[model samples]
Target: MKPLDDQQQACRDWFEGLRTRICDEFEAIEREAGSGASFEFIPWERTDEDGTPGGGGVRGQMAGKIFEKVGVNVSTVGGRFSEEFAASIPGAEDDPSFFATGISLVAHMANPHVPAVHMNTRFLCTTKRWFGGGADLNPPIPYADDTADFHAAMRAACDAHDPEHYPRFSKWADDYFYIPHRKVHRGVGGIFYDHLDSEGEAWDANFAFTRDVGRAFLDIFPAIVRRRMAMPFTDADKARQLEWRGRYAEFNLVYDRGTLFGLKTGGNIDAILMSLPPVATWA
Candidate 1:
């Protein structure tokens, strides 16, 4: 594997550390639910087009009484983008070389009352460098209070850095996470941002904001999980959750950029697809 520069190494470390914290917190929730489940971490590698080693990462997964399925992945990968793909990526058209590090997570709860969630943050470098990611809540059975709490946490994270962030990124999420064909949204919107240039000395603030987003997610999500994980649900509720999961699956497989990026860059199939719920029903 190629040695990462200082910025790359620093971002990579944070992403990995966040993964550890999230996995531990999730395991604790499982224990509280009277399950002894822990995350099974599988390390995987990536190869560049020329067969050179690209950096890889751990895919941490767990199944428990509360969280039916969850995956938290951290990856630091560097390689040259394909010529066809280069033009679409910022700063990659001239030089297809790039590096990216981030954490991506998705949780599917066993109980319908508990909301499913997604959180991700990434730093990518080409001729330019930038940070991007966001968190969104997906509840099969929506609760006004839970949705308010989740958005409040995300807003706090965004407001801490810049007042403009919450409104801008929240709208971005609403636009980005929509299912055009279905004429509906995938979930309650959060925030989505990209091309947050990390050029020059802008790294510190941008990186700090990214860290804050992760921290906000860590702070809020587990609390929500605890609140609803033990709630009783009927077969009708289970059916609703499964049917909603089908929509989740369709979005990931079709419109999710991270999914396409992972596939195009030769990321581990299971890790890339882990965002898909374990069981989903159509029709």
Candidate 2:
């Protein structure tokens, strides 16, 4: 309703800053693997349905020897939601206006041995405001140690905020990232959370928790990538990855809330769809 508050502006800035840090780290990983691949950031504008100008974002993408394809995006957009969508978003039943800012990332590893990954964190306002997002590891060739370490990092991030956070959010991820038709869970679940209301003084604590999640992803995922990046894989391994990718694609296109939000808000098409893998096989 009023001009963006100090806290709201801070959230937007933080998301943008996180995007830069992540892109830099990923590029460094590319270099370590003897690939010169670097992210190319493309900027786009958002326009509201009634022709008012909304904020925009940059989409960062790279393909390299280790990472087959990766996309990192930071977006800050505000405008009215459509009547159909407004009813579903909390606090938007009466006022269709909304504000959202966050960072989202998805990486598809070139080597099948190196697991693919996804992570995101966001803050949204619609009369009511809240924070949400998470990370997960998806490996075609599952490694027990890799899964354990990934979950441990996420649990540490959660435990720092609240003792109940790890168990609650971890289960939330398992439930949220499921493929009903195939009766399979998507990846080795990490953490998924949403609708964490930031009321009054509670905003600071919630924001801090969200930041820790991002920090955990930054610190842990690259370590995992480097661990298996050099491992050799056979033709069968590659085939399994391709098949798994098809399932990943299905979830993003059909069940992902972020994808729907971006499309509804006039966000960049390529950036919104960046979660989809570069290549996949149905069978």
Candidate 3:
């Protein structure tokens, strides 16, 4: 196994910590909500560009009677970001030199009332370095309180790092997560910021902000789920869930940079695609 690079090591450490924290919090939330939620951590391994260097990480799944399914996957894809990665986005074609420390995560909730969430943070280093990641919500049945609570939790998390961050990133998310064809948002927007630089102390601040949001996830998600998990669902709600999932499929396959990056970098296929929900319906 080739030695992990500095950035790769950092990503591995941070995600390991995050995995433990999230699982513990999930367990606590399940107990309190009286939901029989339990999770399974699946250990996985993969090779680098040449299949010479190897690395491994954990993927987790949580499901219950009340909740359909929730998946959390963490992996490090180390090597030059593949040509496929660059090709996925039209403008990225000219970029030649590429090296990246990739970390991606997403949570899918079973209840239409609660909403599904996705987040990915990565450090891509060429001659320059930057951070990118954001969290967004996808509620099946939109309710004012649920949307407000979800956004408020995210806003508080961002504001803790910098007050200006909330509006700036929230707008970015709204724009980034939109579906032009559908003429609707993937969900009520949260925070999305990308390409944060290391110059003038912004690097430190950006990571600090990212860490704060990550830590805040444990608190934010369960609160929303607790309130909505027991709510009654009708066939209509189920139909909407399937309809919205089609939009999600479009975004992940056509637009998600992380998904593209993972595929390009020779990452594990199952791990890279784990962001997809267990079940989805079109139209």
Whose lDDT is greatest here?
A: 1
Tell me how far the alpha carbon of residue 23 in candidate 1 is from the true structure, in angstroms, after superposition: 0.7
Candidate 3 lDDT tens digits, 99-154: 45544566666667778877666665555667778777788777788778778878
lDDT of 2 by residue, 181-276 (tens): 889988999999999999998999999999999999999998999899999999999999999999999999999998998998789999999999
Candidate 1: tens digits of C-alpha lDDT, residues 156-199: 99999999999999999999999999998999988999999988
Q: How far is candidate 3 from the true structure (C-alpha RMSD, Å)?
A: 3.1
Q: Give the range where candidate 3 is weakest over 10 consecutive residues by summed lDDT.
A: 88-97
lDDT of candidate model 1 versus the reference: 0.94
Distance (Å) between predicted and true CA of 110, model 1?
A: 0.5
lDDT against true structure, model 3:
0.71
Instruction: Please identify which of the two predictions, 1 or 2, would achieve the higher lDDT against the true structure.
Output: 1
Per-model TM values vs. the true structure: 0.99, 0.98, 0.85
